[model samples]
Target: MSRHLIYLSILTSLTACAGNSRPAVQQDTTSAITGTDTLNRMVLVPGGTFSMGADDSTGMPDEYPKHSVKVDSFWMDEHEVTNREFAAFVAATGYVTTAEKPISKEELMATLPPGSAEPDSSMLAAGALVFTPPNHAVPFNDVSQWWSFIAGASWQHPEGPGSDIKGRENHPVTQVSWHDAQTYAKWAGKRLPTEAEWEYAARGGLSNQIYPWGSEALTAGKPKANTWNGNFPYKNTHTDGFENTAPVKSYNPNGYQLYDMSGNVWEWVSDLYDARYYAQVENGAANPSGPAKGYDPEDPALEKHVIRGGSYMCSDEYCRGYRVSARMKTTPESGLANLGFRCVRSVTHH
Candidate 1:
């Protein structure tokens, strides 16, 4: 996403993140291997039809006009890909993520509008979006106040130069672009889930429920997912027992035996973001892959992919993105500190 067009998702317009799993480990599996042992870490989401999208308060405009969709059964990761898993991919492929590569003047220009001014050369340095909370609460209109494009920030050094993923191996890997995630999926011989499949799986066989667990609020029960407990973009009450990305399976699993399918980090799915997609798709469409083209009235300069599940930054007064049907979008290159992904495989694939 253009720094100007960041999920500043008009502030990811604070509804932002989900997944499932065992205690995450750097499982002993290779890209070429998709055996039963590896499948153990993945849940088999049964094929079914469900009312997609939500008309509830937590939902955004794109989630309205709820439609029906049918998706086939597929194998899905129980949780967001951990740093441990992503590290294995990097180690095996020596992949250089988009955030690690400097953006050029032309590249930046391409994302800008026709009459936009060119950015300074220094602004083109390699970096990813990092959350910088203020000491106190502030207005919610502008999300740029809390998000910064930090140079030297990448999945390896998530919080920038001095920070590293030393002890966060089990934590979800953030600062990864859609392209980077696609590359990892290809290397693993898997693929990103479609918007339909993701929502269906996120529902966990439930219907019209706000959260994976049910309509109950996150605070009512023992802490459900990792989300901003108090003022967002500033102070996090840590009421969820985590200040940032929590380790996988830190919370209870959903009905589908999937964990962390609501919060922790925003997840990427294989669907172009079309603000009006729900109204457009044929009711009960089977195995929908989203729209043929991307559309975002707010940021029309670049195409965007749908991102699901709110992140740690989500709050009631802000982004209620943790809701099962809540949706967010960002440019394919818009990797942020609170965004990550998981992979899935077709049932037919061995």
Candidate 2:
């Protein structure tokens, strides 16, 4: 059988085991205090300043003109929000994520090229990206290479209608857009962290480190963060103990007690994306929000929003986006298997 089929079988077996158990399974509350819970529940990240952006060596043009940013203290979740926590929110609020809704025929047609096939009826109706290994090489910039507009893919049915969050309760919740994240944040009496705030917290009090763990490569002579460790789009040795998303807080916390700030999943930030936003800030302390209006030439549809802290899919050969300074622009309406979020509050109040 193919690796994908085998993976699906394993997941299916695990799901069955999960579903047979009681809904009120006790989580490791003790670990939660130690900043090691899998629920994406994190200890507060006491925020402070460090250089934001990058020095000349980091190739990305957008990370150019390295600058300083001072961020006030804040209380941040130790990890990205997880399926179990998001399930509670949905159970309480009856919240329906945008990914759960079908794309209208009109909207689908508007987004697709003139000759593209109609949305696949056999696939999950509304789901997020699920990092299935591709049979061939594909472009990273063109999301169509790996992302399938699966139906029935939402916080509940993460892989699609046939899939459920049973065994994956501790996994980070995917298929969540920025709007969905905001809604959950409000419901939880929190809000999305501003990009500055997010970066500062992600730094975990480390100074000028490439990742939350510092300048070491993810492998770093020993198994480190959860990330791809093999050739892209074909094999995943599972060297990091996961081929896709792992349970939240599965790894070590950064210096500031924040978990998964560098990997596992990419997180949403409040700021709108502007490649030049760093340049505009230029070592100043204005605490700037992105442009008042949203459209940018790089992404005309304005669908893209700021996403930081790359996902399990990140690899040195392909996307080194897991770095602390790394930033990616994603569609606000777009949800992917590797995309999830955490909440934050101002230290003074929360």
Candidate 3:
């Protein structure tokens, strides 16, 4: 059956049962673990030697001087943590995400232009950047053209106030910062994977492959992952079964039984943000913890942290960070619709 038809059927069933029962919790629980336990939680990625950075001529300048690095075995989340999973953490711990707090008036005024209307409480409240469809094509380099600061858009209320998880409990929770991810990891007795560990898991035991599924194009006869298919920022044909992020396990897993390691949402890592950190790491068996301090030339006010994997919004025209080597940095406090995370645990045979 066509994907549209399937979605329609699912939507129809959901609507029919919306009034009679708590379908969200039921569907979420079932969808959350539809795949193998290895795919649903962390899988031990046995470490080995592999080239770390990008060597391709088509690669970006920052991903230069590809070099080999050896990583020790580590257990990494096979899939990005889902909304339902994160909600459980919040329910158990009463944790407050960074984005859920109110933004100080001084901090809010700094970003807004002088003579702008007095900021409303809602406007000054900390929220995530939600992508709004632009009326016309805009330069991909300028994210402000498409991304808007939506008030009250946290992990629970993803698109802002009045929006709830509802049927999206199985989807990866967005608007989570690095600190928020770490808190959840600690609560779950896990940790954020290091840059080396994340890359190792993303490679899925494939040596130097461009993507998780080897060098094959994203789609040959069928769509591979959730990514832009049509004119980006204008019309998304959603040929890949979704325009935005699909549910967890919606796509095929890599060789290591990991899902959504490429697209869907960019995941947080434990490393501090440093563009040239990889170049300085010792060639041998050192567990490198990025730079001593986090830094980013783009926005230096707040400390930045490393984020891996490109998001569903990533496109060749804009951010082509879908590859295993692709990396980006964001403030530890910054969260957005495309930002989420997974957890990792150290492997030890009992």
Report residue 337 deviation for candidate 2 (angstroms). Answer: 0.9
Q: Candidate 1 — worst ten consecutive residues by lDDT sum?
A: 17-26
Q: For residues 277-350, what per-residue lDDT tens digits would candidate 3 score against the true structure? A: 66666665455667888655444444567788888877766566778888777666776788798887665522
- State the C-alpha lDDT per candidate: 0.81, 0.67, 0.71
Name the lDDT of candidate 1.
0.81
Off by over 4 Å in 3: 1-39, 106-123
Task: Candidate 2: list runs displaced more than 4 Å.
Answer: 1-42, 106-125, 138-143
Worst 10 residues of 3 by lDDT: 17-26
Best by TM-score: 1
lDDT of 3 at 214: 81
Hey, what RMSD does candidate 3 come out at?
11.5
Give the higher-TM-score candidate: 2 or 3.
3
Q: What TM-score does structure 2 among the candidates reach?
A: 0.81
> What does each candidate score in C-alpha RMSD?
4.3, 9.8, 11.5
TM-score of every candidate relative to the true structure: 0.90, 0.81, 0.83
The reply for model 1, stretches above 4 Å from the true place, is 1-40, 55-58, 109-118
Model 1 lDDT tens row, 151-176: 98999999899999999988999999
Candidate 2 C-alpha lDDT tens digits along 290-349: 555454444354434678888787888777777788877665666677788888766555
Which rank order by TM-score, best down to worst? 1, 3, 2
